[model samples]
Target: MKSSRIGRIPIPLNNVHVNAGDPFQVTGPLGVLTLTVPSVIKIKLYQTMIKVTPVFSNQRASAIQGTVRTLISNMVAGVTVGFRKVLVLNGVGFRVSIRNNILTLSLGYSHPIIYCVNRNIKLHLISPSELEVFGVDKQLVGQTSADIKRFHPIEPYKGKGIRFINETVNLKERTKKK
Candidate 1:
């Protein structure tokens, strides 16, 4: 049986406090994250490291061992340095504003779209067309970014809409006017 190579990699724990229980918990300066550890994998938390091992030699156990290790690693990182996603709006009258934790977006729509910020996530408007989402949970940060972007996803024709900072949109060429 092939063992998980990723599972063999030792996860280095910084100043995060980990509790080995039914639901593994990790707490750091940023925030606290909890993950349900599988029974097939055994987690050993040391003073400065974390080890994940399979209780039984099997394909499922091996796969789960690596998955659990990665989840735990993400939890630790999330509660420590946290995660962030940046979004950019591209359009003629595209604009964004934040007031009282409410994000107001003007994407050529007759009515401005308002998005309430999640308590766990922090929202920052860098400019009229740029925004940043911050959170300790990587999933929440990503999901929040996606939800906001969905309001005005980039169109292939004009590439006018909300998109990630690093994302590249291929604008469709316009036909020559006869």
Candidate 2:
């Protein structure tokens, strides 16, 4: 059986404590995250490192091993350092504001869009066009960003919409007529 490349990577725990059991729990200063370990993967916790290995030498076992390792790694990182996502709006009359746990967005539409912020996630407005999302869970942070971006996705013609800070939109040229 071919060994898993990602499974071989050792995840070093800084100040986080990992409890290995049916449902693995990782606790740190920021927060605690729990994940269910696959039956085919064996999780071992040490003083300063966590190791994941496959119980059986099979293709499916190897795949689960790698996936479990990554999930555990993200849990550890999330609890320790947390996660953040930034979004920027580009367009005339485009703006974002947060007040009283409610996020209000004006994307050049007839009516304003309001989104209720999740208790686990923190939302901040850096500027009228920039917004930031913070959370201990990577999935939560990413999901919140995607939900907000879906309101006004980037248009191919004008490149006007909400997008991630690192995202780039390739604008299509306008049609020419004789």
- Segments of candidate 1 deviating more than 4 angstroms: none
Candidate 2 ranges beyond 4 A from true positions = none
Q: Supply the TM-score for candidate 2.
A: 0.95
Model 1 TM-score on a 0 to 1 scale? 0.94
lDDT tens string, model 2, 80-176?
8899999999999999989987999999999999999898898888888999999888888999999999999999998999999999888899999
Ten consecutive residues with minimal summed lDDT in candidate 2?
15-24
Write candidate 1's Cα lDDT for 93-125 as tens digits. Answer: 999999888999999999999999889999888
Q: Candidate 2 at residue 57, lDDT?
A: 95
Candidate 2 Cα lDDT to native: 0.90
Residue 95, model 1, lDDT: 94
Error of 2 at 23 (Å): 1.3
**Cα deviation of 5 in candidate 1 (Å)?**
1.6
C-alpha lDDT of all candidate models, in order:
0.91, 0.90
